[model samples]
Target: MSTARWVLHLPAAATSAEGVDRLAQALRDSLRHVPALDFGELTISAEDDQSTRRRVWCDAPLGGDRRCALRTNHPDRCLDR
Candidate 1:
Protein backbone atom coordinates (compact mmCIF):
# COMPACT_ATOMS: atom_id res chain seq x y z
CA MET A 1 0.00 0.00 0.00
CA SER A 2 1.10 3.55 -0.68
CA THR A 3 1.01 6.24 1.96
CA ALA A 4 -0.24 9.69 1.00
CA ARG A 5 1.37 12.82 2.34
CA TRP A 6 0.31 16.45 2.33
CA VAL A 7 2.21 19.73 2.34
CA LEU A 8 1.33 22.46 4.80
CA HIS A 9 2.20 25.97 3.69
CA LEU A 10 2.77 28.37 6.55
CA PRO A 11 3.60 31.98 5.77
CA ALA A 12 6.19 33.32 8.16
CA ALA A 13 7.74 36.74 8.85
CA ALA A 14 11.31 35.37 8.83
CA THR A 15 13.58 37.41 6.55
CA SER A 16 16.44 34.92 6.09
CA ALA A 17 17.02 31.20 5.52
CA GLU A 18 18.41 30.77 9.05
CA GLY A 19 15.38 32.53 10.49
CA VAL A 20 13.04 30.32 8.53
CA ASP A 21 14.86 27.20 9.70
CA ARG A 22 14.61 28.37 13.28
CA LEU A 23 10.89 28.95 12.86
CA ALA A 24 10.42 25.49 11.39
CA GLN A 25 12.31 23.91 14.31
CA ALA A 26 10.13 25.81 16.77
CA LEU A 27 6.97 24.63 15.08
CA ARG A 28 8.18 21.03 15.08
CA ASP A 29 9.09 21.21 18.78
CA SER A 30 5.75 22.74 19.74
CA LEU A 31 3.81 20.13 17.76
CA ARG A 32 5.98 17.12 18.67
CA HIS A 33 3.19 15.64 20.77
CA VAL A 34 1.04 15.14 17.68
CA PRO A 35 1.57 11.57 16.55
CA ALA A 36 0.60 12.29 12.98
CA LEU A 37 3.21 14.96 12.58
CA ASP A 38 6.54 13.84 11.02
CA PHE A 39 9.19 15.94 12.69
CA GLY A 40 12.08 14.14 11.01
CA GLU A 41 10.92 15.13 7.55
CA LEU A 42 10.66 18.85 8.09
CA THR A 43 11.89 21.27 5.42
CA ILE A 44 11.73 24.88 4.31
CA SER A 45 12.02 26.89 1.12
CA ALA A 46 11.54 30.34 -0.27
CA GLU A 47 7.91 31.43 -0.33
CA ASP A 48 8.10 32.34 -4.00
CA ASP A 49 10.27 29.44 -5.13
CA GLN A 50 8.66 26.25 -4.01
CA SER A 51 10.67 24.28 -6.55
CA THR A 52 13.82 24.60 -4.45
CA ARG A 53 13.58 22.87 -1.08
CA ARG A 54 15.85 22.61 1.95
CA ARG A 55 15.82 19.71 4.37
CA VAL A 56 15.54 20.35 8.11
CA TRP A 57 16.29 16.86 9.37
CA CYS A 58 18.72 14.18 8.27
CA ASP A 59 16.01 11.51 7.82
CA ALA A 60 18.66 8.86 7.17
CA PRO A 61 17.94 5.22 7.81
CA LEU A 62 19.34 3.81 11.04
CA GLY A 63 18.38 0.16 10.56
CA GLY A 64 15.25 -1.71 11.69
CA ASP A 65 12.91 0.95 10.29
CA ARG A 66 14.58 3.71 12.28
CA ARG A 67 15.69 7.10 10.95
CA CYS A 68 18.29 9.70 11.80
CA ALA A 69 17.17 12.65 13.94
CA LEU A 70 19.97 15.14 13.43
CA ARG A 71 19.70 18.32 11.40
CA THR A 72 20.42 18.08 7.70
CA ASN A 73 24.05 18.39 6.50
CA HIS A 74 25.28 17.53 9.96
CA PRO A 75 28.97 16.70 10.23
CA ASP A 76 28.68 14.06 12.97
CA ARG A 77 27.38 10.52 12.99
CA CYS A 78 23.70 9.85 12.40
CA LEU A 79 21.48 9.48 15.46
CA ASP A 80 18.01 8.17 16.24
CA ARG A 81 15.35 10.40 17.65
Candidate 2:
Protein backbone atom coordinates (compact mmCIF):
# COMPACT_ATOMS: atom_id res chain seq x y z
CA MET A 1 0.00 0.00 0.00
CA SER A 2 1.12 3.53 -0.75
CA THR A 3 1.62 6.15 1.94
CA ALA A 4 0.35 9.72 2.17
CA ARG A 5 2.15 12.90 3.14
CA TRP A 6 0.56 14.55 6.15
CA VAL A 7 1.31 17.67 8.17
CA LEU A 8 -0.48 17.94 11.51
CA HIS A 9 -0.53 21.39 13.01
CA LEU A 10 0.40 21.01 16.65
CA PRO A 11 -1.34 23.13 19.21
CA ALA A 12 -0.25 26.74 19.03
CA ALA A 13 0.59 26.66 22.70
CA ALA A 14 3.12 23.88 22.22
CA THR A 15 6.30 25.90 22.00
CA SER A 16 8.64 23.79 24.11
CA ALA A 17 10.41 20.55 23.26
CA GLU A 18 8.47 18.64 25.90
CA GLY A 19 5.21 19.86 24.37
CA VAL A 20 6.33 18.65 20.97
CA ASP A 21 7.19 15.25 22.42
CA ARG A 22 3.73 14.90 23.89
CA LEU A 23 2.06 15.76 20.62
CA ALA A 24 4.29 13.41 18.69
CA GLN A 25 3.56 10.61 21.14
CA ALA A 26 -0.12 11.35 20.91
CA LEU A 27 0.09 11.06 17.14
CA ARG A 28 1.91 7.74 17.34
CA ASP A 29 -0.52 6.33 19.84
CA SER A 30 -3.42 7.44 17.69
CA LEU A 31 -2.22 5.61 14.58
CA ARG A 32 -1.35 2.28 16.22
CA HIS A 33 -4.21 0.55 14.45
CA VAL A 34 -2.61 1.05 11.08
CA PRO A 35 0.05 -1.62 10.70
CA ALA A 36 0.81 -1.41 7.02
CA LEU A 37 2.72 1.85 6.82
CA ASP A 38 5.53 3.03 9.06
CA PHE A 39 5.82 6.62 10.14
CA GLY A 40 9.07 8.42 9.40
CA GLU A 41 10.53 11.63 7.95
CA LEU A 42 9.21 13.36 10.98
CA THR A 43 9.74 17.09 11.55
CA ILE A 44 8.80 19.81 13.98
CA SER A 45 9.02 23.47 13.08
CA ALA A 46 7.96 26.91 14.18
CA GLU A 47 6.33 28.89 11.41
CA ASP A 48 6.19 32.66 11.44
CA ASP A 49 2.50 33.29 11.32
CA GLN A 50 1.36 36.79 10.51
CA SER A 51 -0.31 36.98 13.88
CA THR A 52 1.86 34.61 15.90
CA ARG A 53 5.52 34.20 15.08
CA ARG A 54 5.94 31.02 17.15
CA ARG A 55 3.65 28.15 16.30
CA VAL A 56 3.95 24.44 16.84
CA TRP A 57 4.46 22.23 13.79
CA CYS A 58 4.63 18.45 13.91
CA ASP A 59 4.29 16.16 10.94
CA ALA A 60 4.91 12.51 10.07
CA PRO A 61 3.99 9.76 7.66
CA LEU A 62 0.40 8.58 7.58
CA GLY A 63 -1.10 5.54 5.97
CA GLY A 64 -3.48 7.63 3.89
CA ASP A 65 -6.23 10.20 3.97
CA ARG A 66 -8.43 7.77 5.87
CA ARG A 67 -6.21 7.87 8.92
CA CYS A 68 -5.44 11.56 8.89
CA ALA A 69 -8.66 12.69 10.49
CA LEU A 70 -8.29 10.42 13.49
CA ARG A 71 -5.00 12.01 14.43
CA THR A 72 -5.91 15.56 13.53
CA ASN A 73 -9.46 16.00 14.79
CA HIS A 74 -10.23 13.17 17.19
CA PRO A 75 -7.77 13.36 20.04
CA ASP A 76 -10.10 11.38 22.30
CA ARG A 77 -9.45 8.24 20.24
CA CYS A 78 -5.69 8.64 20.62
CA LEU A 79 -4.03 6.70 23.42
CA ASP A 80 -2.66 9.08 26.04
CA ARG A 81 0.61 7.22 26.24
lDDT of 1 at 22: 84
Worst 10 residues of 2 by lDDT: 52-61
Candidate whose TM-score is highest: 1
Number of backbone collisions per candidate, in order?
0, 0
Query: How far is 26's C-alpha from truth in model 1 (Å)?
Result: 0.9
Cα lDDT tens digits, model 2, 19-56, are: 86577667656875776434333345554443433222
What TM-score number comes out for model 2? 0.36
Give me the overall lDDT of model 1.
0.83
List ranges where model 2 is wrong by over 4 Å: 1-13, 35-38, 49-81
Give lDDT: candidate 2, residue 15: 72
